[model samples]
Target chain A: MDDLWYSEYHTPHVRFSVKVSRQLHYEESKYQKISVFESPEFGRFLTLDGIMMLTERDEFIYHEVITHTAMAVNPEIKNILVIGAGDGGVVRELGKYQGIESIDVVEIDERVVEVCKEFLPQTSCGFEDERVHLHYQDGLKFVRHTDNLYDLIIVDSTDPFGPGEVLFTKEFYGNCYRALTEQGVLINQHESPFYEEDAKAMKSAHRRISHAFPMSFVYQAHIPTYPSGHWLFGFASKSLHPQRDLKADAWNALEIKTKYYNTELHQGAFGLPNYVKEMLKDE
Target chain B: MDDLWYSEYHTPHVRFSVKVSRQLHYEESKYQKISVFESPEFGRFLTLDGIMMLTERDEFIYHEVITHTAMAVNPEIKNILVIGAGDGGVVRELGKYQGIESIDVVEIDERVVEVCKEFLPQTSCGFEDERVHLHYQDGLKFVRHTDNLYDLIIVDSTDPFGPGEVLFTKEFYGNCYRALTEQGVLINQHESPFYEEDAKAMKSAHRRISHAFPMSFVYQAHIPTYPSGHWLFGFASKSLHPQRDLKADAWNALEIKTKYYNTELHQGAFGLPNYVKEMLKDE
Candidate 1:
């Protein structure tokens, strides 16, 4: 297929469809759409849920910032769980650390795994590694049975609608809290801070997560495909602040190519604006 | 009026219309279309040549970072020039200093000034100040007749199209270099770094600006209305780098109710990722 069609929620009733020269297929069982497009810079483009989610050029930034921030903070991160990471981008980032022995990825769509293996080979490299275990099931359902078994859990789902809507609720966060070890950490992708409604919803979700966990914070990144270009990620941990002192050797050991995330950016990302800091206060 | 209509250029051929609430009619004279709308949380919105541009919330972030960075570097600044700031937002930020003696505003469209005065009252507040001198002419033409005089020259034009296209060219930047004092500064609003095409264009523009000026750098801000949520501003100075020792008392003394610009942010704005720093390395 030369043409791919998809829709994004711009507002409450505003949905826009964009067409691009690519091949896209939807999996009924997973209710997820996987797309593949040829690009010069990143090699191949992978998108989910009708959005151009990640490209070959800068996937490391999103994956590393989300995973390492929590993992580095809690030193004893052995067993981890990644919820809804069908592309295996997070798993690829998580696999970099020798300390992480096993990682379980709960993806609603099995076709996403198949498509990633075929089209986005670079991101699918994690599946070949012995450390990662793939589980084809609902993330919310998987977490209920697995309690106090994980050191870190990352909710790498799409927008808070359809299959991901329950991921943003307090009940799911409570389940995630119970599924973690005493010093575990949880990170979820929050929407744009530019949209007042979305920001408020994300803030409310963060509040619920904070009530369940001891420490919670929000950080942002500039993602072109998302609405408002700026996207937020909420971090919650049982005992530690997200900011961890980077060992000189470990900081120098990162080998992945990234356009947005770096040792400097890792520090700057946690430094929030006074307004955003104020918004997250007393939560 | 309850319903207001305006268009935005996502791509060269892709134009989207935004329906707002209020509109100030500008008599058709020089430009194709000019109007101002009172948007929610976006502040005073300006539409020119059928393109919706400039929202209030983050406008100061762009203007302040561009102006203050250059101004802080220079020990002595007497005269300044602003090109295409129809709403006088940059001028408002410029007028914050008691040291600035005079400001000349060269705007091509008189309709934007009138619309801003009538509808976007807050943005037009700087025009009413006695220190500001408004001139109705093209910035390119205005700069050619001027000699080396201004301490600071800010090119606050829109994207590189329509009447604002010349502002992005090498010839215009050469003219600006000639129009500035021996130890002057020049700043322009470049496109976002998120989009590779726009980022390349901005890097090209930076290369041209570097040829005329001794030092050149690029910084970014998060503006939602723009194509990418992240926007870049290029800075060129003759004698000084854009870093300055900000006096907390002096900055706080300027009693401006700013939504974004602050002392800590001023320093933080220059902190770029390894990728951004790498992009500007050879340029």
Candidate 2:
């Protein structure tokens, strides 16, 4: 590899590139193309279908934020169902909680799990926990078939396009709503609010999620590796306001240390800027 | 002229690029290089010394958050001193408040202001206000000579390498502390914490500011064009907590139609992630 560089077009006119040391692994799975690259600054990163999924250096920010944010809101949450989190980063974060009884992960392609388990043990190590169950199937069908089982449903899917397009539909969100317990919480990887395609996806997901769950809300985190370095997440719950119902004291008592997620930041994350609020509210 | 793409290396290994339609203007100022570009997605943007300053698209987030965040903390802030904001964006935001009596902007390079005033009136129009007085001199000397004059001091300087390096030193911070009134607030463009070069600057600035002001704090905002898309700002005051002192109702009643800054976000912006908090505290 002579000065190998990987570039992703954030928009038609905007591009972000990384200087790669070399390609560690590349393979075509049943669902998408997965590749691992060794980079100097970002460390080793995994990409799916030419889109960035996780990098070893910054993956903790995304995984810890998504998992601990919900756990802090409802400390009693025992059962968690993660969809499309084949990298096992979300499951790895969930395993930190002693109270979580069942960690069910539904990944469409088993190859993603196998690749991660081999190359990315930092996250895939969660699979060793006795509570985790890897279900190799489609998440859309899994949620539609089940009812009132999970306390939390985490949709950690890829970008809302191609094979992952079905995950953003209103029908899929309705099924997630039905698949959750009374005090259920559904958190998804809402797309970026920048760029045309990402903004379109973000708006659509928020609209669909709002239709299924009346208590849908959005939060932001700065994941520098993402499209805009600014990313949003959808938090839909039955009757919990993330800020108002935050179990800060209770969560603090648990002493679950985190790099990104904190009680003060949990309240702050929900404080969307006026522009993003207008975008989400405009429907 | 043909397929022109402007790329800024965020780190040696990480690069961010935009497809440029054309170069609007290019010149060598007495201090550094100044250039402007027109891009499809980012609109028109300015760069000095091969580093991005601001773009028409997302400039509001930077200007608004920097200006309004401090204003909400102290609604009575009438005198402001801005350093190195040659683009006039800070002055434009400062002019929004009728109570602000004086805005003294110090830019070492006068050509940067002339270029922006000619080609970037969206921000440079701020020079129209009678209260704004531009002093084309060193900000370090200006602060050193003045004492107890400004109610707020905003250092919107470039990165801490070139001529702007003096602004991050303890002596300069001590000068800024002395150049403020009793209820003074000092804010500066602290660098990012991800990359090594940026993290070094951020830590240095925080360390220097803490030595001058007891109430030194750091806040974050998502400005995607900058390095790593995770930008930090320093807020040092005599006796004020950004979140606790935020006059949300007072600021809201003013009916300021802002695109990014909001009362809720003002409180939230100061809630740093644990890692960043640990980084700042580590020094």
Candidate 3:
């Protein structure tokens, strides 16, 4: 156990790893590789293709920010369409809201959902809620032709590669824009901005979202498990503003206890560094 | 060359590494082991006892925040004291200010200053400033018995272990408090609050500083090379509130161009997550 280390190369030049006490499960599904490991520091962590996804220790930060940021801004969001979050972290937070009417989850890999239910109960508990409807299919195709729509669309896919690669394309974003209500919000995993590759992906994603939506704002959060420990999320809407239209007063009245998300931090998260702002600006 | 990698264990169970082109320098100074490596992603990086200190790519984020956070709040700081930043990054930023009359840098290991000046000229350029004075001695001892007064004291020491363990002691904080002017400011490299061991150090340091200073506040930044990429800095003063007494208008008026440090982000940095606030709480 002393030498059992699970390593992932964040870049070709940079690697991050944790000491594994034991490997709980490992399998290759129809889409990609899935792994569940129990570690001393991060507790139980799930990885896809050897890339760290979520840990029992810090997944709250990612789950809360992704779900609550848009929910706070648009309290009128009656329906939520979650794309590619098979682990159920996003829905777990969404389930806390009594106002939301229904949640439609489109996950390409059903094995990820099944495995998470059996392993990561902390995040998978949301799957048990009756309000959540699960659909196993290609999210890209689902968005391309869907009669059923939502007021909020959350793109919680993996990196801009593999099966998740299609989710980042301008076509998928355009389809998502068409599938949403007139006044809808789009939130996606915008990747990290530190390494050259991740930064390229982040900027490209921002640009594509901008083309597909009337307004787009990129915000950041500290997720040490991710590459560079700095991760970005893109907020795009048809017409609503994240700040000027922020319903902080209403969100605060929910009294929903959160570890990371707050009205104050929601304001601060958009106050990104000048360098990051420069990178996001289109030349 | 294809397989060479420079690795550092952030915690007992976590390991981080960079693919190295070559080892630039490796030596055991009178104080500790000093090594430098060239990497494709991070550019050039310096390590002490296998701990990554700074990389050429992201050093600006650390150096800028460490100096500018205090500088923005108190622009009247003419005399300054820096402890243990032998890399000269702090002085490099401090040197940008035209009002800074004198800077006394007390680093225990002169070899670090020498090696940095020779190999890492990007950060070591400030050593050439005539207003800079280097005092090679134990910072704990120097602060305990210095008649020299400073308007601001920057504790840029390493982690609270080995040579740096003393700097985190209540005795050292008390000495720093005594060595400052009536309205002087104190800024220190407070450890991160993510990993168990680092969180323990960070909490203890905050407690010690709280005991010594009249006012103490903690702020965070994203530093990917560190243990968790979520790094923090301690800001303590006699009576100045970092937010209330914040001279944002004055700091903004300076028009000092920066890559990371900005007034809006400064105000936002103090908004900590609830989990972090709970960890920093005194029972």
Candidate 4:
């Protein structure tokens, strides 16, 4: 009962810790180590490979930002593909949109889904939705082989390490570009710009995606559980620009109540800090 | 050094850890325990009462945010009063403006100033400026008695606990309201809205200040060393509105080179998340 603290090293010299009341569940999945813990502050939270994935208190922000930004951009979005969000939080957010006809989630690990379903029902609730098709396979391979094109593709993978490393490759980005329709918008979890390792990944992802897509940009969000609490998401598309093409009025008409994502903040989030802008520019 | 990790309990359940290479110094002043640690990631970071005050790596965002937002709104600000910024980070930022006439800093703990001067010179350099006047006294008492009026007042105090608890009181805010000129702007380190305790403080500060000032608003910044990485600052003024009265061109004409704060972000930082907006709203 004493000294039960779960800590994750954000960098070699920086770490984040949470005092665990008890271990709810733990299993070394084929892909990584999946564990769930109960805490008074964050509530029941899940971690994959010793890193925080989602917590009950803050999961809404991450899920809402990842899902609603693209949905708001393309109100007519029908088909969507989600990569590596096995917790089903992304699917839960997409389920809110009645216009979204089909959602294909490509997760590398099935254990993440099963464990989340058992221990974390809040984020896993939308897995029961009929439109959500769960494909337990590697996301890198999924984007390469999938014949059906999607209107919006969201890559909700981990950092560019371990199993998530392939998801950031130029080959994978090219495949995502090809798997998308002409008007398709590609968004991925670009790493933070503060730390050295993450910044390198961020710049590399931008370089690759910028080459594949005609119009590409990076937006930022404050996700406390992540490293440095400053997180970035990449937006790349063939034609649509986020600011110019953002139909704020049209999206507001949907009246989808969100905790974090708003039409104005959507535009504001894209107003990257000057340092981040410098990092994203071709060097 | 192998097992040396400095951890701060963000909440009862959540903690943040940094691998300390060595302890720079430690002393218990009349007010609180002040300690400095050297780490590879954050360089030398200072902590008060076992809580992180600032780190060398991310101190720019905090100092830039606390000072420039108000300065940008009121470009004609000349006489400024800073309360509780003993580290001199706020003064260092104010030193950038050549138009600044006199900068008065009121701090309760002389130990914080002396220790930071000996160790954290990057932030303490501005203390040597001839225009900068340092007062090693209680900020709450200084504002009550000082007859001089200031165009801008920056409250760079710590969280509303221990020695900082008095700085967030209604009486203290009323004193600040009196000490300010007709067009003066008051900005304070409003607590984060993510955690419950900090959210309570944030709401209380907003409610009290909103009642005191004719025009009041809350702006946000992403400071990772902080509890939630999402931190807030209160902007209360006698007549000036941050957005409406913002002289972006005037501020830009000054050509103060900054790494974080900019005129565009001066507008964007006020765009709070939906939940934060709800928290700030009168209940």
Instruction: Calculate DockQ per candidate and list them.
Output: 0.35, 0.87, 0.78, 0.72
* Each model's Cα RMSD: 4.1, 1.0, 1.6, 1.6
TM-score of each: 0.83, 0.99, 0.97, 0.97
Docking class of 3: medium
lDDT of each residue in A157-250, candidate 4, tens digit only:
9888899999989899999999999889998888898889889999999998988889998888888888888899988999888888988999
* Residue-wise C-alpha lDDT for candidate 3, range B115-234, written one tens digit per residue: 998889999998988899999999999998999888899999888888888999999999999999988899999989888888899999999999999899999999989988999999
lDDT per residue for candidate 1 within B1-283, as digits (tens), equals 4545455645532233444566646456566577666654465677776655676666666666667766656535889999999887888888777888999999998878877887776678989778999999989989988764899999888778788888988888999988888777898987766556777877778788988788787767677677656778887877656655445456566564555555555555666766677777757
lDDT of 2 by residue, B1-283 (tens): 5799999999989999999999999999889999999998888999999999999989998999888989988989998999999999999989989999989999999999999988899999989999998999999999888754888999999998898988888899999988888889999999998889999889989998998998999999999899988899999999888888889999888788899889888878888998899999988
- Model 1 fnat value: 0.32
**Candidate 2 residues A1-283, lDDT tens each?**
5799988888988888998999989999878899999899888899999998999999999998889888999999999899998888998889888999998899998999999998888888878889999899888998888754899999999998877888999889988888888889999999888777898899989998998987999999999999989999999998888888899999999999799999999888988878889899989
- Chain B alone, TM-score of each model? 0.86, 0.98, 0.98, 0.98
- List per-prediction Cα lDDT, in the order shown: 0.72, 0.90, 0.91, 0.90
lDDT by residue for model 3 (A140-255), tens: 99988898778999999999889999999989999989988888999998999889999999999999999999999998899989999999999999988988888999999989
Interface root-mean-square deviation (Å) of every model: 4.0, 0.7, 0.9, 1.1
CA deviation > 4 Å runs, candidate 3: none
Candidate 1 docking quality: incorrect, acceptable, medium or high:
acceptable
Model 2 CA deviation exceeding 4 Å by range: none
Which DockQ-derived CAPRI band holds candidate 4?
Answer: medium
RMSD versus native structure for model 2: 1.0
